[model samples]
Target: MELLQLQYFQVVARLEHMTEAARSLHVTQSSLSKTIQRLEEDLGVPLFDRRGRSLRLNTFGRTFLMRVNKALFELEQGRQEICDLSSPDRGSVELAVNTAGTLPAILKKFRGTQPFVHFHVQMLKVEEMHALLERGEVDFCLSSPPIRGDEIECQVMLLDSILVAVPITHPLCDKRSTTIAELKDETFVGLKRGYPTRDITDRICKSEGFVPKHVYEGDEPARLRALVEAEIGIAFVLESSTWGFREGKMKCIQIEQHDFVREIGLSWHKSRYLSKAAMAFRQIATDYFNS
Candidate 1:
């Protein structure tokens, strides 16, 4: 079968609508239908069951679609590999992280070796990272509270403890360690509920029999730390996050009663393309954390 037929089939299987798939493929409905028919004839079984304007993958279609996806992914990766071999010094690496502030040192270290490499980094909520990886949209994802999926592989770079940051004037500032139980009633300044940090914080607090009262929930770390600096509320922050707040009266207290840890890791799809620059960046990221 032609590669175009396999590509069309993949898109049709995903959209499941003849008109939409045809539009997306920039081909006519009849042409698309004819392509599928030819593919089925070559395969000796119908791949989809037509339902008016929509199509559903039959049992055979489902099995064949999986293999088709893998084949397409590999072909795309091979095409990239051929293109990337010509330009080793100047390549782009697309990476996603749950938080932006966590990667400066690691990125700086990676850039040290590959000065010509460019980064296309995005700060995404952890929930969205897996989908980005699965679709091959990003070469790497530094996920926190690491994602679990058979389609991707993740390596734990570090286990960062979630610490409590409080204003010096607060009662717990002088304490060396505290518990979620002690801080249950305390209001928190953190990211919104969809973030891995927020989710982990809520889970840990729930284990202590209470939920956090978020005084503020926004995407920026500066806001979270600023709120704590103003004594507006305490924050559940990473141990590394407290470094910026350390210059002031903010105290980063360890959570002694619970592990209160987050697993930050490097993740990529099992089948996604990785250029030389991307692979180098990945190795540096892995080494930077492990060292």
Candidate 2:
């Protein structure tokens, strides 16, 4: 009927004596007898045959004992899983990110130091990262900022400036730095509208009193670089995002007229309680960056 009743039936079935089972379970013999009687009454069957000073389990009691033991074992396993999820030494951390530049270092350091914690990293678009955080699908996100919402909390992790990407043969590639006005006549390959990098580019061009004439719009870093190699259009990317530019035909030019810098950071829903794994990751990330 109930878990306690099932447990009493199991113990009495095993010991084959009401007094012995109650003594083993730390209960009174009368209480244990009453519990077993209630269980048998609820099931509409006798669980044991009582002879003179002896008890033996009936045929139905053997089958029911097997099922009850299985249920009790599964219940105990579920309780242990919940305890592991709450413990700092044995929980999982789910992190979402739009860019990969800063993630590798953090992952390497955290894994090395806290080997007990497991990590689940999701490579997603800026919009996807925000939506996942809002829905509580991820614990936190590492992304470029100007992430606006009253329900979100953000901290500036690092500062990065914009770089102008152009093919080596292009005329602007020879310059060490370029202004927004100087890039007005150039064709641009921009990130999609929803991304933070694209927003930064738009803000910079607007400050210079012009909207960029985009020849292509995409979010794939590789494709953006390929378009630059074809001399199709220049692109604005973070300085760190140009890590492999020297291997390709493209060169990076620092943008000088406006600050055009973005703060990369971790963001999460303001009201969500962070799991132990997530909290440890936040502390490790902050220390690694600050150091």
TM-scores of the models, in the order given: 0.82, 0.60
Tell me the whole-model lDDT of each prediction, alpha carbons only. Answer: 0.84, 0.80
Clashing pairs in 2: none
Give a tens-digit lDDT track for model 1, residues 48-123.
Answer: 8887777899999999988997788778787778868887677788899875565898889888888998888888
Screening candidate 1 with a backbone cut-off below 3 angstroms (N, C-alpha, C), the clashing residue pairs are none
Model 1 lDDT, full chain set: 0.84
Write one digit per residue (lDDT tens) for candidate 2, span 124-178: 8777788766545566898877254677889778787888898989998778998
For model 1, state the Cα shift of residue 50 in Å.
4.0
